[model samples]
Target chain A: MESKRIEQLLNKYLNAETTIQEETILSKYFTGLEIAPHLEEYRALFLYYAQSKTEYSTQSIQLKTKKQHWKWISAVASFVLLISVYAGYLYDQNKQAEYAFEHTQDAFQLLSKNLNRGTNAVMYLENYKTATGKVFKELN
Target chain B: MNQAEFLSVVMPFKDKVFRMAKRLLVSIEEAEDATQELYLKLWKNRKKINSYKSIEAFAMTMTKNYCFDRLKSKQASNLSLVHNNYREKGLSLDSKTEISDSVSIVHELITKLPEQQQLIIQMRDIEQYEYEEISEILEIKPTAVRVALSRARKTVREQLIKQHNYGIKEN
Candidate 1:
């Protein structure tokens, strides 16, 4: 009688019409030692299913914490990289400004020296003008 | 959710996820990698995890997609050399020791099925998910899941019986 029920359930299972409960019954029936010889061909298949269910991954699952830890570390590393890059850029700009300032100061010094030479020429001209005026007065 | 809460909720189904991955990828190591990848994805999207109705279904769907992507990229790169190697390795790994020769034949038969049928068998027969759950994970109608599952079961059955008959004749 039990074997008859098993046969029906197995048929239903093959047709994909069996409920989970019915399928469970069928799997349980196959696991037993007394499976009818005519039905014995399916024993390996059912046994495979049963064994397959036991195949939990022995590899440990790495939780989010460990992975998140890596995430945090990488984020910090990238942030530090960005900050140093920006700082180097700022330092370069400051150096460029100082260089420009030094070049301009040198340019101003050269211009002032030329102007002083021109002022000395103007002083010579003034002396010449005074000497000519005194000669004109002696002629008068 | 917080990490602890998310872990408590999703950890219970980790094995199921791994099994789904293994079924698709066929190599334990590949499956493990896929499982790890899936979990990392889940963790990254933890904020939206609760929005789904079934976390298990969502995780299984993710596993399926991720494994398929891996297989596609692998095929693109290696021309399926590693694919066959993994199938052989999986057969050997599964058939070692007390497992009979017939069992390995079933494993081979399973690998021969299409990806959809393979997943259906893995979930319905081995993992014993309900049709509703299978439908949700596969994003197919329940009737379609049943039809595919029935076809898969019948194919495995016919092939296994034929192999058994041949073995008996040889002996």
Candidate 2:
């Protein structure tokens, strides 16, 4: 009776009308130890299908790197670019500040030198006037 | 989806993609290359991958198309597949060779079949995909999938029975 049911299922299987469940049942029957002799050739056929499912390529897929790497590279590049631009701007401002400081120093030195010279001249003039007044008083 | 979700969804079926490619391509090397190539392309469009209802089916279809393109290119250069030369390793040589021989015979017979039937058998029988699933992958009607699959099985069965009875391998 079971064989009769399997035979009917096999017919449907060969016609491709059986459900996947029926096909699975047929596969199990054929792959089992006791395949019907008349259906022996069909055994290899089902066996082949089972064997083929495990026939995957040994090559590993390493798609993790390439596109993701490019994204990281571009992000790093822009980051470096941003840092360099900001650094250059900071350097320029520092240079301008240093130049302004040196210019102010030079201007102060020039003013001090002129003022010292004027003070020296005024001291000499006062000395000359004092000496002339002493001589006139002695003559009177 | 994002990378984690994408990998979880796709990596499980990555071998299935490779197997599908192997079915279409000539050698293991070609199939591996095709699988990697298909995955890379999928990665590039991974952002839109979630839009697909069944990413596994989509990837299978992509693998099929990519491999066929490679096949066509090979054909354009006047090259053809040399079937029946593949060796299954790691088996103790003497005992299983006879069975493997039978298996190889069936494999050659499959390759000799017309393209549509070959793919139909691969999808329906070997991959154990549902008829509706095979129809979706192959872009044919469900009834048409059954018809083509039946015809392919019959061809295999006839040749296999002939081999058993006559002990002669014939195309």
lDDT of 1 by residue, B144-166 (tens): 99999999999999998898889
Write down the TM-score of every candidate: 0.81, 0.69
- Give the number of the best model, judged by TM-score: 1
lDDT of each: 0.89, 0.80
How much native contact recovery, as a fraction, does model 1 achieve?
0.77
Q: What tens digits encode model 2's per-residue C-alpha lDDT throughout B1-171?
A: 676776787888877887777777746777788888988888889988889888888888888888888878877876433433433322232135345677777776887788878888887787778877888887889999989888888888899998888763442
Candidate 1 ranges with C-alpha deviation above 4 Å: A1-5, A63-118, A121-125, B44-48, B73-78, B95-98
All DockQ scores: 0.60, 0.47
What residue runs in model 2 are displaced by over 4 Å at the alpha carbon? A64-140, B80-99, B168-171
Deviation in Å, model 1, residue B37 alpha carbon:
3.0
Best by DockQ: 1
Worst 10 residues of 1 chain A by lDDT: A59-68
The fraction of reference interface contacts (C-alpha pairs within 8 A across chains A and B) present in each candidate is 0.77, 0.77
